[model samples]
Target: METVKRVLVTPEAKKVIDQLSKQHGKLMFHQSGGCCDGSSPMCFKEGTFRIGSSDVRLGEIAGCPFYMSRSQFEYWKHTQLTVDVVKGRGASFSLEIPLGVRFVIRSRLFTEEEFARLEPIQNG
Candidate 1:
């Protein structure tokens, strides 16, 4: 059976991830819940941003692990998140900000079949 991914990345976002990875080495992503960046996805160097047990590991995008706070996950659990890049600087510390772009999440609700085959989530 084909596994359904909880998180995905667009080609444009992948290019940005590759560029950032080349400079920063390993990278990871966190879905911010309406704080510094308004519900935007933040990128960080792996092991830099602290991931606590309260966070949920959605999946990987561009070889980097993606996560969300457990509280936030409660609301987004039924949706598949797509990491997309936009052409504007965001007011956050995400790596992409310096490059005049920010990582944003585009989500879609999963169908019953897709939900049934979703990849298992992990506790951070």
Candidate 2:
């Protein structure tokens, strides 16, 4: 069977990731359930943001591991998330903010067949 991806990245987003990775070695992304920037996927230098035991690894995009708090995952478990880049400055600590571009998520509900074949998630 073909592998199912929980998250994907857009070409525009991939270009941004390549640029950031060159300047920051490695990276990771986290989506939280809090207000403000917390709702958006925040990119950080790998190992900079702490992943908690209750966090869920949705998958990887552009070679960077993507995670979400378990609580947040509960609300998003049925959808496939795609990371995209947008021209705007977000109020957050995500590295992309400095470049005048912010990462955004574009999501869609998985089909029944796709949902059944989703890859398992990892904790923290």
Candidate 3:
């Protein structure tokens, strides 16, 4: 059965994305394994990761574009996010959090470049 869930941006995450977007850059996030288990998805977006009442706002972190993750996108896709009912808007889809895996939201949506970036990593 198909499912739909929404995503809400955390206040702290919003701050980080906002600062990065202003610099003008692209947010790149990766999930890696380690002993200490730095499980929280890492934030490496160059530009802003902004969050508005409707869309996730990105300012400019390092002169690049920022974005979000598949899982994060999925959460938001399904409407799992908490935003003003009349203000915020997120993509609606069903995304499952992979087992023993962490994700990052570099920005809000996926683009051709980001898709290409992720393909290699996933295949490798």
In terms of lDDT, the best-performing candidate is: 1
Which tens-of-lDDT digit does each residue in 1-124 have in candidate 3? Answer: 2222222345554554445445534453322222342323334542223333333322222232223444444343322222111122222211112122223333244444443433211111
Q: For model 3, how many clashes?
A: 55
How far out, in Å, is residue 84 in model 3? Answer: 18
TM-score (C-alpha) between model 3 and the true structure: 0.30
Model 1 scores worst on lDDT over the 10 consecutive residues at: 29-38
Off by over 4 Å in 1: none
Per-residue lDDT of candidate 2, residues 3-92 (tens digit): 578899999999999999999999999985778776788999999999989999999999999999998899999999999999999999
Q: Is candidate 1 or candidate 3 better by TM-score?
A: 1
Q: What is the lDDT of residue 16 in candidate 3?
A: 47
TM-score of each: 0.98, 0.96, 0.30
Q: How many angstroms is residue 96 displaced in model 1 relative to the true structure, after the best TM-score fit?
A: 0.6
| lDDT by candidate, in order shown | 0.95, 0.92, 0.32
Clashes of each: 0, 0, 55
The top-ranked prediction according to TM-score is 1
lDDT winner, 1 or 2: 1
Instruction: List, residue by residue over 58-94, the lDDT tens digit for candidate 1.
Output: 9999999999999999999899999999999999999
